[model samples]
Target: MTRVRGTPSPSAPARDDVTSLLRHASLTRFLIARVGSITAQQMLMLAISWHMYDLTSSAWDLGLVGLFQFIPGLATTLLAGHCADRMHRGRMVAICLAAQAVTAALLVVSTATHSVTREVLLGLSLVLGAIRPFQMAGQQALLPMLVPPSLLARSMALSTVVQQISVIAGPALGGVLFAISVVTVYLTSAALFCMSAVMYAFVRYDYIPSPREPVTAESILAGLRFIWRNPLLLGGISLDLFAVLFGGATALLPVYAKEILHVGPQGLGLLRSAPAAGALCVGLILSRRAIGSGVGKKLLIAVAVYGISIAGFGLSRWFPASLLLLAISGGADTISVIVRQTLVQLETPDRMRGRVAAVNTLFIGASNQLGEFESGVTASALGVVGSVVLGGCATILVSLMWSRLFKPLATRDALR
Candidate 1:
């Protein structure tokens, strides 16, 4: 096969032609596949939240949605990751996309028919959550196949920004569309999922998984043991996990919009977007700049920045101030996340990528959805502001402690 002008094969490090890798068509298609799926997912979330709240007018219902979403992620992540390694990764991704698209269509039809019941919503949410971990794991594993290692960092960063773009737009659009008709929101979200499935269909690249002997239970266990023993990989994944577990404030946006900031639903959209907006800007910067040695230290500092920004946002009353603070928080948090993801991708062997990526997904999924549950519970117990402030402080302290504990992992340079 002829290599593109910019993209190197997986065997080559991407540092040689970073510019071309970023601009390559195949990479762009991969990005589209990523962005479309993520955007549709977030849109469905916005729709679900808005629709549920509109029906019940209860915060507890919103929290329950988070619970349902997180449970499947925790339960299925390892299995999903294992499958990614053993199966055709692209096809695995396609299967997940198809499942999600079906869920989206179901959501739309239910809404349009006015048959949207709580039971139906909860069931679909569970199915979506179950499949999402695999989609996430598969995509991450498939990435090294799309670009060279040197460019993996940039590609991952770019992928993050692109997903954020959808998130930034999805909720705001969902909010507006929901006011007009929940059916409209669901239909639009379903359309995006279909687009994503179509994009994945066209990706056309085959990822060659590591050739190992016959698949057995021991082989899967070996992947788990690898992550268990690798201090750097363990530390990198844990660092981000613990940090976000405490500091994730996305769950509190609705409360802030209503009680504290007085922005209402539209304001909620903007508030939800603040962090992504900041992360998007930072992603662009990292795409141009190369990561250096001692990225561990950088990761720690960035998380601290993230903690401080979350704290500042917690205290903020002005909309613009809150937005700016969240943006700063987003930027700092993004750097830490990107570094962690890059390290995970670089450190793992090809044979173990699915398992390791699945573990990564489990931690991150916990940080995101379970963290939301924690935040909501804490905010309900304490005030929203109190929860945000305390969570931010905990995040900073945890990152510092983890940095010390994982000193060996932090100090090492990239594998390439």
Candidate 2:
């Protein structure tokens, strides 16, 4: 065959220049699966929180739910990271999804049978907590393998956008379902998880398992060691840990929805969705615009803004005002999340990605759960308004302290 070769096609380069993050087949498939799974998870979370409060109006009981969820992640962090490094990540994620589907189904049954108690809910949270670390570690580690290095930041931003979309929609859906019947919410969540598992099955990727090593105490501690040794990573992770631990005002929304805001379950859903609504908008913007220089300073500024917004949320009595405040907080948080995740992913080697990701998961899980627990405890003692205000102030202080303490984090200029 004789072919005349001329100038190369401009279409190829033009297509490459287009900035859509979902261009890659593997990334697109993974994101679709993630959207389904995240939507289900968010719906389930709202259902569980509302159901727990309906059973017992006590704040401490709500806190215990978070505590139970945190314990499993704390206990099995190392083992989960190790598994992500050595196991088939896709298969592991599918298995985790299967387990979660079963759990959701059980909740449906329990709700229908009128046997769903706070204790039962707590138990299920423990099961989920155990499954989450492994699932998250595997997914985080697998992302770099799926996308070109240059597209990683955009991919992360796009992922956040999907998650934020789910966060906004899921709670609204859950509230509608819960209004019809609590059982319906659980059933829908179960169906979504099963669907997510099927979508995950379609993702094509290869896992290069880490070299085999004897499971030892030191081996298990590798993730923690890596974070500790790297100041930038340490600062980024710890900044998030402390900020969320102190500034988490969202945990008290259920209380505000009922007691302060005078809103019904539907209204509660709106409140739950507000922050994510803001986050979704911000993530969409970030997906297209690259993070420029002074990445560290931007992160710090974002966290401080988050704290300010949280405080504003705590003081607002009007529903619209509160929602706006929460949305601003979410927007600020989105920036911090993007910077922190990108930093962690770009800095770590592939061999250590799983372990480092596990450590990051632990910090995030702990901050969320423990923050919920703290909010609940403080609400019980200090009153909801006081607790939220105090926590928000603490978050602001944390941001300042971290900026001074970890100069490297504040001085960071670029993603690479």
Candidate topping lDDT? 2
Alpha carbon deviation, residue 409, candidate 1 (Å): 3.3
lDDT for model 1, please: 0.79
Instruction: Flag regions of model 1 displaced more than 4 Å.
Output: 1-19, 208-217, 413-416
Candidate 1 matches the true fold with a TM-score of 0.92
Candidate 2 segments whose C-alpha is farther than 4 A from its true place: 1-20
The weakest ten consecutive residues by lDDT in model 2 span 1-10
Residue pairs in clash, model 2: none
Candidate 1, residues 182-275, lDDT tens digits: the string is 7887888788887887787666455554565565667656656787899988888888788888898887787788788988878887888888
